[model samples]
Target: MEQVFFNEAAQDLKTIHDLLRWSVTCFSAANLWYGHGTDNAWDEAVQLVFPALYLPIDSQRDMCSGRLTYSERKRVIKLIQRRINERIPVSYLTNKSWFCGQEFYVDKRVVIPRSPIGELISQEFAGLISDKPQKILDMCTGSGCIAISCSLVFPESKIDAVDISEDALAITKKNICRHGVKKNVTPILSDLFSNMPHKHYDLIIANPPYVNVKDLKSLPHEYLHEPRLGLITGDNSLTLVLRILGSLKDYLAFHGIFICEVGNSMSDLITQFPDIPFTWIEFDQGGDGVFMMTKEQIIDMINLYPIFNV
Candidate 1:
């Protein structure tokens, strides 16, 4: 197909489509909104752009091929332009994202699912945590991805999904049903262990909003589309992580472990708690600051190592 160009006199949909197809290949659909442009050297290549990565044209919906006619290309280009003008994430443009080999519906209601928790589940933290867990607690379980993944890997284990926002919980519930894991995964609306802890958890996993003030202040345009409440926390974002870790002991069963992903603040946490042992979990995925500690670990740290308490 020949490349097309935009015309101001009268909109030429065909010409616009050709230009967009040419333009899209030179740069990523996500990168198209950014500051730079790319040279048209690479071959026209396209892959599964996520279920949520919607094509910009209605004419191309049923067709899976990347080839877009002139008019079709123009429609998609217009959509991208609109989103760029509005500063919306292209993920939201498609309404889907892939996490742990599963396609999940995502919107501005919650943050996109990106965490080491998925990798940890694949490793079966159930087996790695020293004590085998029969019950799991997924705190701040947005979209229920963590809880749903946990329930699948640990069939015999029961999971409690806790979140503060009701709308987020609704999305999570839908995912749980989508995967048919409702029997083992329970959704509860609690502001961090408020409704639970009368019961004990064998393992507690959390991927809270630990992005510090600096990151939050200047997050990428794509991230701006997510609910800010789920990203920015405190001046350092350590306050919520600390409060959550401090509260874990009360709900954890004896020898139970707690895993929390604090993003880039793991070093900061280590400096803050020099005495308490933080078994930071290593990961291949691009996630850091996932620290693990058992109830016993916290008990000793609180009683004997008060200097380490943040």
Candidate 2:
């Protein structure tokens, strides 16, 4: 039984190193999927164990040999078990996630912040937008990570973090407060641009649901813990994305740029709009299916594809 293993681990696992090793072994044996924050059992073990012990993620190697208190060991054991049994991502377990080298609060209400858009933000969206944006929009801003990160990068800019789900907006507000971007980041409850202000934005970013029905059904168990509202992009997958593209020109300034992540729906987007020129961004840090386009391009695309002119 799990209780027996807990007792044995509590008795036999003498130090952080022992517990970390045990966690890695258990995770590997369970064949847990690791895509939220970490990719391997060892790193996943460290993420779960170090945080449970209130130890710094960058704690020295010597600290691994240090003994853990009974309570600390028990907490780590329970978290590890929950991760394996529930197939929850480590960030959700810890209520923490990182983007653009900054930490944010997250839970089941929002998908864990792992968008490749962080790399683009870290570079200040260089070469994409010619000038500093005075206004920005983060569509489908779940945890408000993208909007908060942009606010930090462009403190002078006013940002709108829009999400249809009130629960998600709550998380977004929590993150906005956590990151101290309350002055610039405003959370709005809207289905895409339905309730957005009439003014146009100098920059627009989105990480909307783009998982196709086929891919959704085959996703790893760990992904099942994330909200369906934040993952499924309708049965055809391009439904929400097409709507975004259709209405994007209304919100994007003349010189502004639009960025979005469609994940595996990249093919669907291309198939649906073959002539639209979308510049797919390549990240050195590693992610795909994110693309960037300018306001002019969206206008042109709409002109060519009138069906997208909603």
Candidate 3:
């Protein structure tokens, strides 16, 4: 269908609300997927429009009447075109995404931060954690949102953010500085725990690429904009996850807790190691497939699963 207001010779859209409504209509008509950060057309429109106008996302209703300058209108239209035509995620277009209620710089170099692990961090691990962690590790710390958010919650904890992709680490470094948690969060270029220093973490968290090959192929166009290395695992979707589990015992403190977000791979993971018990975490806000385990539990299961090489 031809977009009415987004076409040439169109001049009716003028106010912020007008453009937002038009964008929502355009997005819905285009059948755009909204899994990256939003779940519907209206929220996606606000994500695109509010940042484009340099206004707060929760701005007052009166601000919607403010008129957009010609340049601003052109810029908004261009962004909308990119969203509908190119299928780029809004965060990549705006170079930002919010996680755990804090904003972080983002781009195609890294996956957008939308992990449910943020929920765990916001609650500071609550009942799962017995004591304050002095050291933490965020494996596959894309954009460093997990590590940065941890720093905010545990100000005294030292965080090591590790990623194999140098480009992703570069983005993580930028976010670490952006959040002003430089001293506490350290970015490391490591594939899992290979290059990480010999140190034990009281808590280790990962939001690794757990999408199986099949699922990766069927992801929406918006997800295609992200780095595939940050999403696609091997056929079983446990390639990286198993590797992490293999080395977890060596890096986790005796009482340390491990949290990993495996997305839809939870069922496959359970099937692979049915003898081992994993605490499937549920978020009140919404999100699933994340599991938590204690170091002692992993040690006990290591012998039962050959993946741990016990």
RMSD of each: 5.7, 1.4, 1.5
Candidate 1 lands at a TM-score of 0.79
Candidate 1 Cα RMSD after full superposition onto the native fold (Å): 5.7
lDDT of 3 by residue, 1-310 (tens): 3455466513667889888888888899999999988999999998888888788788938689998887888888888988998999899888879999999999999999999889888998998998999999999998999999999999999999999999999999999988999999999998888898999999999888988878877888788888888988868688998889888989999989999999888998898888888999989989999999998888888877676784
How many pairs of residues collide in each model? 6, 0, 0
The local distance difference test score of model 2 is 0.88
Q: Sorted by TM-score, highest first, which candidate order results?
A: 3, 2, 1
- Answer with 1 or 3, whichever has the higher lDDT: 3
Count backbone overlaps in model 3. Answer: 0
lDDT of each: 0.68, 0.88, 0.89
Instruction: Specify the poorest-scoring 10-residue window by lDDT in model 3.
Output: 1-10
Q: List the residue pairs that clash in candidate 3.
A: none
